[model samples]
Target chain A: MSNWVLKGLQSGVVTTRYPRKEEKAQGISPGFPDIDSQGGDINGREEDVCPTAALYGDSNSLKLDKGRCIHCFRCVRNTGHPVSWTSGFEWASFTEKGTPFPKIFQKSLYIRVVDSGDCGACLNEVKLLNNPLYNMHRLGLFITPTPRQADILLIVGPVTDHMKTALRKTYDAMPEPKRVMAVGSCALTGGIFSSGFTSGSGVSSLIPVDIEIPGCPPPPLAVLHGLLTLAGRTK
Target chain B: MKLQETVNQMQSRWNTELKIDLDLSAGTAVVHCERNTVPPLCGWLFNTMEYHFTGLVPEEGTEEWKLIYFFTGEADLGSIQVQTSAPLNEETFQSVSPIVHAVDWHEREAEDLFGLVFEGHPRLGDFVLHDDAWQEGLAPMRSGFDSDLAHSQRKPKSNWKPRKVLDAPGAFVMPIGPVFSGEAESSHFLLETIGEEIVRALPRLFFKYRGVEKLAEGKSIHDALLLSERFAGTTAFSHALTFCTAAEKLSGGQIPERAELLRIFFAEMERFRHHIGIIEGICSSTGLVVAASQAGILEEKMLRLTGKLTGHRYFFGLAVPGGLSRDTDDEAIKEALKEIKGILHDLNTLEKLLKKTSSFLDRLEDVGIITPQQAQDFELAGPMARGSHFCNDVRKLLPYGMYPSLQFEVPCEREGDGYARLRIFFEEARQAAAFMNQAAAMIKPGPVYTPYSGGEGTALAGVETPGGASWQWLRVDKNNRITRYRIMPPSFANWHGFHLAVEKFAFQDFPIIKATLGLSVAENDR
Candidate 1:
């Protein structure tokens, strides 16, 4: 057991220098589809290829809704006129009625994670934030068990029917200076599980979403961006 | 026993002439029987013939409801499916749970989803859909039920209470989750105890049930594949592979050689990462902070490696009907194998230290024991059953992909304790790494994708996932649109036996025991 301490000390710091320095790891993110500069008309075939309707428009104009894009690469891989793919992890954005937390709660914030009906990928990525590499502790972010002590509510999954009340009750229990961050494509636009019988379209339908991190299951760095954005610390 | 031999014995013993259809290539025999003979047939198959009851798939027909019961034994015996039907007017059917205990949850699930009455099931409603959240009669899986329209919320059942069997002055029930700290998925547990020792444990899961099967009713094969992988994200590639194999079988398409080898490589990679995550969970549960963090770092490394090799961290959208959606570069595969070898060396050092740690061993040695007999009775799958010396691995028993050609050991432990499960996990991770190395070496240049013109038929495909054997049954129309899609995940089978390990253990041992089992709530809930 004493050797474990030596091993730990010898290994040194493996944590990413994110928010302090850029994490330039290759293939760290699956990336989102952007309309290519040499874009052609959005024909019937192009519009119908996406499984989630993330890419849709008339012949004159095409739209890419990053919230609904699961990064299936259908548009980029299977179409005649491909949408250019952009690879980076800083994809968190503020919602329409969303704002960053106040200055007082910026340095130290407690997060309450709620799994409304996630498929497990989003939650897995969220758990990885606590690992040695992407240690959120160094950034003054900690996960609290209860909502009363939490200043941020980090939610994953499209809200399922059975978890509706639990999610609502959890949101209501939080104090006034609370912000909600929805991670993963499912939590943003319900992704593939959208409009199902048992699940709501997304978390925003049940509660106001402050920050949106989109991907099928957003990579750990992207989720970190969401948290940093919530704390008003992201560059 | 061979398929024909079993059929002849059944006909002679029951003294009933049965209509049988055999597909030699697929190694399946379909036996049509009356509704009244369903119970006796299932009993004869399970008790006398020693066949393992796989699962029961209920399909809604225009005029009747058809129940397909899947059973398997040795690899040579293949699969036997008993087909029976009930009139639309008559909703009740005989329950086979009393005779075959493994059929309990399947019947309860069928009853909950289809509103079919299994006459002798001990309990039915409130299995998947909680009575507090849903009305009693709303069978979501029925054809008449709309998949798009959200039903009205029902009033919470004020009088609803968890089932309790212990009766004593100090007896009390403690409810554990639907929402837990950390990244644990939503699942509730009721631990009934009079003291530190728990007398009974009732697990109430499916708080995250998104009606995966119901949503897949009218979807095309491409769309349904997305649903299959998303339902359980940890073993995304395995489920996708299973779904693709079923689709391939239905269309009579063959996968290329290189694609098959690549499938095995990716599957083992997924298993290696999954077991590492489980090891991390066990370490954390036992309060070994440094070791857990080390394991977590290894897990993250594997995830990043997977993301580099395949576009997705979890190998979603990589598997399609006939073969893989995209081909992996051989140079990249070789490089990844080199990195994996380094990780394996570190894992070996960690395992040696963990074995010598007396505190960790003390907590795990005999804390939660599930005997081999209990494992068989509950039909537990994956490492959970292997830890109990069941030696039931789909890769060996029902070889798929390149498992038949590749050599690997299915490790087992006689002691069915938490320590045994942990050891099995480490050993399996080693074996998975070996498989990845071998598969990478065997890769040859070939077309990875084959355009399979979808045909109309029903087929069953099974794959050895990290958790266990996950079977997918697909029925498609002429237009390649799915009519019915059924997924029997390994976690669903293992959860039935989870209570066996938890019931007699102390309160403090619950988390460790659960960590050792490493069953996924989302997988089972789906």
Candidate 2:
């Protein structure tokens, strides 16, 4: 026991005082694009450079949907538009359906995130609530692993064929209070690799989505915020 | 690499344009074949080549379906992919589980998601999706399936139910979790244990199989990067790395030198912490306070370093489509390196002290001795495989990131036991520190990350994760949507080796043994 305590002490305190403090690690976390005042053609350039179409175009500026971004930085890094963001870890929400992103009417609204098809990272990020680091538990936001637990069932991928039953089952499991949320671009509109035989239409084709959070795998904080918005937990 | 040659040879055997793409920076060989040839390809890789089973990603869609097979050891990267696929209507194939015992759960998962019928598979019905609504001919993985059956014209579930357990001798079974309070994603393990020995174990996963692959369909190239990253929890970057590499190759994006360095840093950071966590879990299973404490410290330190460098502790949001997310500050990283150096020194002393402890050795030595032959037959990789007399590091076999520039030794043991695993962790931990020091000291600072540009076709990226070999095979259509994205993490291939080790051992050792296998249920659940 003495040895254990001593060993732990020697390693020093390893907790991150995020949320309360500005972290340098997440320069612009949640896959947020670094917005360096771009030239007049930045919007077109961002769109031209963007592979997943996560960058939304306004008459003036190109708004990036963090949720649908895979952190590729085609618009920000590769292109000279100079919009880039660092990693930000502080993401939480009032509910699993919340959206940390601001609502934009012309900016592709009303969506649901479906696992349409994805590996488990997007879901794992959703499940980080139990962990003390991103204590999403305090926000009353917990994932059901079933669409029944969701209102705006956030979809992650382009929807694989095998998961069709599972996704349908999840949607069936959910109550009437449900609204689908296309969390990543894959769910909202199908990012890259959308034309394959296994590829499915966007989440909108499968279910009625009320919201969308476009990103590759939105930052944990970003995800929390997204869920919170769905629960109307965002102040 | 030897894998490239094997891939070249395999191409002659297969003229179906199923060439595998290679991402040398990430260290993987991906063979994206058609759905029909998946089973045979898996058998070939497991039997002929040195590859072992990693996993199968069964992506469901409302209109289409795709099941991806991921393997490691000897594969082709930096080239075209060899693929063979079939429609969802014809979802029957030979069982690779027989050839690669590690692939049983993956096969079951595929059956659960896409409704793929594995001919000759013993326990193939409803491994994960337990709904009675599952129909024999109607596969779920198809892309045309309705996202919401309630709204669909299909009739509601009627006089149908899950098959009741048969009344056999000691056939009673107990189930545990898609909702269990634990780490990783949700999953259930149904075991028929007799007197503390598991007679049979069936995995009930897919509680969160959200058609991840299906979500990639029709999306732009950039959008698939996010889809690729979410394949698994612990190793998100590795998965996305493969996708990004493939996309980079297809699109013809240039990865700057500094971006490559940062990539190596994050990968090593992920590996260092994961190893510590696994080692700690092993110690806790054996009640080794000293070792566990040492490992816990290591874990925390590594995580903190991860934060200091990339922001997120788990290194999430680090790997972008082309390069890194954020450019790690040089001085800050230098300072972190100094602190990590101190921790490494302390770890060295502590690990040495642990070897002399009898209680620790008693639980580990020969406690699950898998002979070298057995290990090879089982096709083990990562630390577990290394502990069992096999040299299976994707980094060593295929130099990726800063590995080519850095010099290191991969520790292997003849005695395939828990003791060997522990010792190897220690040695590797030291080696990790050495590598980090070398990287930090010698690594020249420059532009960190680069975004991808899609032009021609899809590519492949493979990386050596802590679990062994993690792979990603991705293809983006002309419209920038994900045509196919498949992943295989190390844990998927190691399921059999762990089960084989447990066959003779008492149930009491289940926790430690399970921990040693370190297979992530969520990873295989996809």
Any idea what lDDT model 1 has? 0.87
Report, for every candidate in turn, its global Cα lDDT versus the true structure.
0.87, 0.59
Tens digits of per-residue lDDT, candidate 2, A1-235, equal: 1255565566564333443444454322444564444542335443345555556675257675543455554454344445545444333322244333344321222222344454444544454333344555455455444444444565666664445665677678776656566655556565543543344555666666666665555545566556655655445
- For each candidate in turn, the TM-score is 0.98, 0.68
Error of 1 at B516 (Å): 0.4
Tell me the spans in candidate 2 whose CA falls farther than 4 Å from its real position.
A5-235, B1-92, B96-116, B131-135, B148-171, B182-184, B252-254, B285-294, B360-374, B445-451, B496-498
**Candidate 1 C-alpha lDDT tens digits along B330-420:** 9999999999999999888889989988899999999789999998888889999999998788888778777899988799999999999
Candidate 2 positional error at B522, Å: 2.8
Evaluated on CA atoms against the true complex, candidate 1 attains a DockQ of 0.66
DockQ of each: 0.66, 0.11
Model 2 chain A poorest ten-residue lDDT run: A104-113
Against the true structure, candidate 1 reaches a TM-score of 0.98
Docking class of 2: incorrect
N/CA/C clash count, model 1: 0
